[model samples]
Target: MEGFPTVELSGRKQHHCAPLCLLHFGPEGKMMPIAIQVQKCKLRCSAELTELLLRRLSQTPGPDCPIFLPSDSEWDWLLAKTWVRYAEFYSHEAIAHLLETHLIAEAFCLAMLRNLPMCHPLYKLLIPHTRYTVQINSIGRAVLLNEGGLSAKGMSLGVEGFAGVMVRALSELTYDSLYLPNDFVDRGVQDLPGYYYRDDSLAVWNALERYVTEMITYYYPCDAAVEGDPELQSWVQEIFKECLLGRESSGFPTCLRTVPELIRYVTIVIYTCSAKHAAVNTGQMEFTAWMPNFPASMRNPPMQAKGLTTLETFMDTLPDVKTTCITLLVLWTLSREPDDRRPLGHFPDIHFVEEAPRRSIEAFRQRLNQISHAIRQRNKCLPIPYYYLDPVLIENSISI
Candidate 1:
């Protein structure tokens, strides 16, 4: 917004936002958004803009912030819903899909390759998750986050604001958030109805935990073995220093102290790379196919005053043709799975050869199949089926 052509629409409303949305479950166990507050960022509220319309120019979003209701005029309701979609697009693509799954998995891939040997047990456990991660992330840096990339030219936030969101989210991120079960429990969404994400993810996490505990116990045997491993210590330290930036407040452990600690950390890495990435990645196209639902950019800023909105003005705020095409093209590229994709729990590679680890892997695969079967049965009765985490559909790593 710093360099936006604010002069072009000086006579009209002078505001920019993507609006925050609050949602709850509907009676039939479906999602229902009740209120959506207009999102405000740093703005240059000029004297030329309306005095009462300063409500739009306000930098702070508060309890009194403007929102839309069902009774709002047709155009106003559309605007509010569009803004809420913008919020989803920004938070979903940038934070959940990109930052959390892709970048974080890249960190684990780098640390393990640098600090651990190919034959090491930890390497055998983690290397499969690193497949195609480097290639995809390299493409992301070159085309997405680079100067004048898709985000800069097409998205409303542009390069600076997108990067700002990334920085702020990273600063606030904690190790607790990465661990599956703890994250749901901490967010108090464990009991939320129609939450297939929580249920499927926790099941995957528990299965991965069982597999990890078995593998680690076979290799290390005791807590003392875990503490005495030099390569393991180095890998953890590298991730703490380089990936987490050594922030003690981040709650990322700098070293492995016990068998349980090692098992939990490794389980987190596996779950994040495989099932978590799939849960967010697979549904991207489904949500973004209709451009208005998750708009790449809104052409006009929001106005506070009622009756100012018209059908023509509403259409004007939508993304132009070029912007929409480029955005949809990029999402399609990122969302689609490749022909050579390996589904979760299906490791065709011969990375782990030892009988004990091989047996654990087989058991893990069986558990994932059971989870998939259960999800299929559950979805038959659900109003909307959730197949995002089905083992047969989920990729083993973030390939796209």
Candidate 2:
């Protein structure tokens, strides 16, 4: 079976390879002409090594030929070959492509492993110069959060450095962003086909908000030792100060706003939900009466989005808020654990899903219709008062 090409690849060999083509060695010492032409001829006898080599070669600069891989054979390898060979293809670009074109659950499993770093050759080819849209997995998000609390000596410093880089990248990316369809495909998902479908202005903003919330919950270090360390504290303070000061600056690129907004949102969410997420950052976290062990049925936290909640309540007041709210909900819904998720499972949809706890779908629809009625009026966008959120904050804090 062969892999196919969707977009043009770099170098002169582009034509020789189809976007979808399979490259496998045939019987004897000779190379088989799969979807891609074999040039290196460094065939490995081990099937595991052969697949790895083939996948890597396919990503290499190819000729001008349109490469085509028969879709039927992507998962056709013998069961015996699955174990040894699967791990080696961890960095295979085709895996992401396969996920976009086929099974989402499988793509999700691969994404959860975090085996492929953003620096992988395929990543460079696919997401070049794009840092605003990060590829996150549960493990990757966990590592960033360090939910285990056992931070070793060198790990904290590495995390801090990475966070610094991310912060700068976020503040530089544009707000009125355009996403190529291939970017979604690279992330192992696809958007609905339409001009408005790929437009992510709302998703970008929601992602920034959610990211900020995550940072507040997970990334901020709170140990006295960490806070006491002048160097580390200085870094945190400097970054935070920069974010606050530059937050509304017109000079800041919309592209980069997502990053800072995410950092800020994370800060607020952590402050609201569990101070522990911000424990390592502020060193002021105290275990309060609100902390308690939640049941397994509720072990996974339900979706929480302030923007979406606000948007829903004031829908009649603002038309743009409808689009923004739905987009926010879509972005928020994607990050929920699969077991706890509703519709808008992985991407955007025309209709919004109700995320409130204990609400029936019909009831949710009625409520949404009421809000839509208000939005249709000439009402203007109004800010959601902060006082009303205290109970929600307390509830979330206790659950954590």
Q: Estimate each model's TM-score.
A: 0.89, 0.20
The top-ranked prediction according to TM-score is: 1
Ten contiguous residues minimizing lDDT sum, candidate 1: 1-10
- What TM-score, to 2 decimals, does candidate 2 have? 0.20
Lowest summed lDDT over 10 consecutive residues: which window, candidate 2?
293-302
Cα lDDT of candidate 2 equals 0.26
lDDT comparing candidate 1 with the true structure: 0.80
For each candidate in the order shown, give its overall lDDT on alpha carbons.
Answer: 0.80, 0.26
- Give the backbone clash total of model 2: 61
Estimate the Cα RMSD of every predicted model relative to the unseen true structure.
5.0, 23.5
The TM-score obtained by model 1 is: 0.89
Off by over 4 Å in 2: 1-400
